[model samples]
Target: MLDFFRQFISFIPPALVPLALLAIALLLVAPLGLFAFNFLAIKTLFEELRKIFQDIFKLIIPKKWDSAKTLIWLSVFSWAMSLPTRSFVQSFIAFCGWLLLIPGIHWLMHEEKKIKEFLTIEKILIAPWITGALICFFLFATPESLPGIMVISWPIVSAIIAALPKFIKSGPAYKVPDPPVRQDLIIMVLFNLLLSCWIQLCYSTQVWLAQYPSFQADDLTNSSFVVKTPSNESAVSQGFDILRQAETALKDSLQGQSWSQVERWLLNFDDRIRDLNEQIIDRLPPKAENAYWQVEGRVLPGEYNVQLFAVWKGPSSDNLGYHLAKTCQISQGVPVDRTPWQTLSPVGSASPNTQVDTATVSCEPVTKRIKGQPDMAQ
Candidate 1:
């Protein structure tokens, strides 16, 4: 068994060895820690911590006023004061929010006392469950401070909201009637589990949107419940920008050249297209696999046309996936006298009437979806 452990440890990456060892140590220590929690020394330490909290609370609050009432009123006052500014309000709200939970739980426990004495309710005072729940609520309420982690906070907040009432009602001290477990308590537990799963699924949809932004551009008429449709500015508009840049490059490099020279440039156009792709990749965020701009060019009489396709290789209802496309047209610019006519001639000799036309490019608006895979480059 020791040799087997050694062999397993060797398979772990060098950087992860310490983490793996720490995890193993935690697994071994957790049961021992739980068993030791009921020891007299541990109880003494907890009692001391409780005294420290009480002392701190007394120092901050005046003895003349009720502590819970004062804290609640002050929190309300601070909230009203913060409404107009909307700046640094989240931090103040978070601080007061968690503090409010102390009185909140106290009120709940006090109300439950009116019914019957529950020994289990007293145990909750020593435990940190309420503290953890309040922290989750604070995180969920103040999204601006930690937006990325808000999704994780939702399920914790939901579970606590669903179970707290039931937890307060079903104390172990309550005598069991005809049924050992109350039907309502069982139903609440099952309902809370389903609610947590639903919350998780909602967050997962948001993750999918982040991975495939084009989905945001799709019809959200039926998906309003799952995802709020953003503004037109946030839609899949990268295809238009990519085509615009490619059109600019075509005009900058191939403009003012004769038809013959332009033909020669087209022969090696694939290299130019490849360079454009490299430049685009460097400028934009890393796209999903096979989801990049693919440009296909066509040569027309005295003109060149190219199609820019924004390919998507991510989750889609369609098997072939989808793409956005825009077409760019390149035409000749006004004629200009060739430098060769003036430079090559003698100083006294008259220059010939030789001129070369330059090229210009214009692109059309992006089509929503081209439906099929992009055509091979010409």
Candidate 2:
């Protein structure tokens, strides 16, 4: 397919460069794939969508049972193309397995119905494994899997085409046909391929949506500090060792003064985070997708959201002890002994959707839930 594109781009007259470029961009990056070339058409809307999806999913999930041969071919082709690397063998095997896996599933189930009328794990395993082994040893032993996969899909595609009328006879929800292979099986394949490409587009768009706002929060970057000490090292170097080193000096300077130890530590910590943020510049969101930070609530109507400023202030500054002593704005601050403000997410910080507005994590608790590490807080 990529080869075809490479050839296609070379054939266009120089005057038609813009049109060709447009087509290429749409083919590779549009929300829907190169829609025109696919030539997929369906009379029924719902069935069309179903068949289309089954086809589309092949990109992410192979359609092995759709054709054992195609699966093997695909595996071998992929293996070969991935030269300058040797791991393609495993991938080829897996692709072939998946190609046969699902269809093999349905086939064994159909066979079981003819006999026991019910399925057992053993009954399901035999034929698919046998088919997969045969495909690997006989066909995919070479690197023709790319076109091989296309060829392999034909018989399965043909079978699907033949069975189409029967599948729909049962009606929409009752038993929609698996593959929507038509006389133009190539068209169907292309259609599904386009849909898969659309999915990739949406995935990329989603990531952009999530990341753009953070990037825009350039001014907010200063909200987290990156202090460079006279030592020419980040204040954050060696896990707050810099803070600890400054602690004794601070304590000496505060001789007979009444500031609390934890408060002093937090002050220095806050300064550090602030300095980090100062080091980074701020940016605005791109017009393509307007970005903002938002949080969610788990209550009945989960739409309850809290939008935070792009540039954020750390929770440690808003820690119960500090907020109580200095701000006095949040009168009923969280209890000191209770859980700290943290996120349950992988990063251990809350998104705007979370209930916990601020986070405090403790690594030394006896009954810690996160193994030896502290739970993340927001």
lDDT of 1 by residue, 235-291 (tens): 764555566666667767776667667767777877877787667646666655325
Off by over 4 Å in 2: 1-103, 109-183, 214-378
CA-only RMSD, every prediction: 27.3, 31.6
For model 2, the local distance difference test gives 0.37
lDDT of 2 at 123: 37
Off by over 4 Å in 1: 1-106, 109-135, 138-183, 201-211, 220-234, 285-293, 296-303, 340-352
Per model, state how many residue pairs clash: 2, 34
Whole-model alpha-carbon lDDT for candidate 1? 0.61
- Poorest 10 consecutive residues of model 1 by lDDT? 123-132
TM agreement with the true structure for every prediction: 0.53, 0.18
Backbone clashes counted, model 1: 2
